[model samples]
Target: MRVRAESPGPSWADVGLAEPGHGWSGAVLAALLRRRGAAVLSHDTAAHLHGMPTPHAAAPSSLVHVTLPPGQRLRREGVAPHRRDLPAHHVGAVHGLRATTPERTWADLCTRGAPWTPEDLIAAGDHLLARPWSRRGRREPASTPEGLAAVVAALGGVPGIDAARRALAQVRVGSDSPLETRVRLDLIAAGLGEPILQFRLDAADPQCPEVDLYYADGAVALEYDGAHHLAREQQARDARRDRWLLARGVAPLRVTAEDHREACRRLVEVILGRRAAGHRIDPRPESTSQSGHDAPPAES
Candidate 1:
């Protein structure tokens, strides 16, 4: 099926109907591949294929990005052509469609002249290095810090490589969501030292719960409660975990989706030995304290 009419010729042809779940973009990519034997998806297109998180500020575009050889070009109404000879190792198959590897896609994105902020780039890198847990179990990270470093080194002297390097320095493993990365960056910018990611209270206990971000010196744990935490079952589980931490003298700070900045502020206050006043900081009842005594609203 032709995707757009204003193209020089047919944008995409339906050779055989795309696989059941390939989606429209996948179908378009398949058609482009058939027409141009050496086209590979790159940039944002490849990032989506690899399951990277989209920046919240990014405006949706209908353009499909494809990279072709230096002398070859395929300009169409709904297509953005990048003419560069990608190394063989940088190209890979994602769900049957050829696309840039996660590392290459990241490098391409950093240098693509897009308006991605430093935090945006760091979040993307954290995603690439994150080993998140799912119903199936802990999933393997898409790429490693070393792998990303290699990509930057290979593309040295390329425009925007410096920005990529700067972001990479701040990228850490174990960030489950962009919000977590954002909060961590905010804390660092506020002059709070970097908190440990995925800190387990007991290393020997396989069942020990891990805190999203832990400041050992202050014994504070910051949990970024995303929308998923609003579920009744998850909330109960979180409550139990908070109680467990409280019993151990660790201050558990629950940060919901609505008030991350406030949460960070409370955390800094806790670290500086001052009680934060105003909006609720702890997930427990206002009257309860870590010591199981009736406590005032603010920590003392």
Candidate 2:
């Protein structure tokens, strides 16, 4: 691909399509690497390459983020350059192009400053720690909670390390999606005590269903229903699970992307015994069951 005017020639060629598809980013990174061998794709670009969720607001699709050594700099039209000393362990390869490791990319994002909030950082951390399933079997997590903590600890003097540390403290291992992380954070912020993540009703039974967020004291189970719940088959399965939970005296509350906040508010009232007389807080009228499937991993 002929990426730059001043470059010697094409660094890579495509034998298939005239227009590059998903590999366009790789081609751009390759060309940039040709110009400066030390530069590596980092920040949002690395996050995307590592198959982690990249917040759209924090990473505009138009710009490719790159990191150079302490004194190195590259001013390119479509590239955003960051200067930092990346250790050997922090760098990795994605599709043959150099890029920061998933953990490093996440830490860099936390320290990137404004537009990257604590909630965003927490969500990213949850994603990194989540062990998603695949056709082959359960896949290993990108990083453990300890791995993220070590990264934060090593980044002592970095600009946003404090925010990263705070987010790290809140990151849990079982949240399946960013929405679940967000709802958990929101509920905690609202002064509701932290709910146990991926709570299983029967701890000894491997076949027992797990709730996304559960309050053992009140027997309240909060399940965040994402777009996948719209499927007819999933709906039927959810209905069965809800029936089973209700039969067991568990209050199975469901929250969709749209009504989560309201659900949380109603839950607080019910938990605190503040609901008005004759008022009742019910699960989302649709399906009130946990999603048995894990959140699909991001595309690599």
Candidate 3:
């Protein structure tokens, strides 16, 4: 039910008292209503409302995405009108405003006409499938990986069907961040063998230490270090874990947001060399760094 609002404005009190963060979404919803009473917010606008990754300029002042009822046509400045019949299940209300469900929003983004790149589309898909972590613990996912596949199947002839299919094929479960998705994609593009995701150090303990990407047979673990991983506390913990992993004959590698692509290339070479040599590769270069931390997070 979240809607975008511009600035402080009148506030979205009607939609449960708009907090400062709701201002942009409040304004977005209000504008959609003013343009076409029955228009349903959709595409990137819906993606933003659903708390999904979107482009830099997806705020209210940008083009507002709305899908009108079939055969209801009208054009106005600053509004993008989508002509389609949204089935009941594909449409839903959030924070008080009508927007496409997460599945449907992703479908719209994947369609041919949408501007999203394949990497971003896959990233969004990963976000949709990865289960949420709540105070009580991990919660049920908003949609399943199978459900997303079905969505792409149902939209076979849609505008971006081909791109959607490609993106869907790239989506993976347990991807916790866009950076992780990017690294996976980069590795795949480099023709490296697929790395097992979120591999645990102890299968018996659900809360056991895990690596971002792991090669089980080779005992090679790769981690994507974001800025928070550089904190002293996190570094200390990582140092202990790295030492433990080393003691157990596992090789640990770290890639940062700034240098993951190149690092992944080097990793592919290492993996290939290890596969040829028929043994685990030793951790190198990066291991010499301070406290075994990875790269810093990108500045906002």
Best by TM-score: 1
Off by over 4 Å in 2: 1-24, 56-61, 261-263, 274-300
Worst 10 residues of 2 by lDDT: 291-300
Worst 10 residues of 3 by lDDT: 290-299
Report the C-alpha lDDT of model 3 over 1-300, residue by residue, as the tens digit.
234333533444554432332235465566556667667888877776677765422332266678988889867666678988887778888766788889888888888343577888888887887666677976776776667776667666877678777777777776767787788777767776566666665655444456777665467777888887989998987887787678777778887765564746777776667666665533333332211122112212
Which ranking of candidates, highest TM-score first?
Answer: 1, 2, 3
CA displacement after TM-score superposition, residue 38 of candidate 3 (Å):
2.6
Give the winner by lDDT.
1
TM-score, candidate number 1: 0.81
How high is each candidate's TM-score? 0.81, 0.80, 0.77
Better of 2 and 3 by TM-score: 2
TM-score of 2: 0.80
Model 2 per-residue lDDT at 80: 84
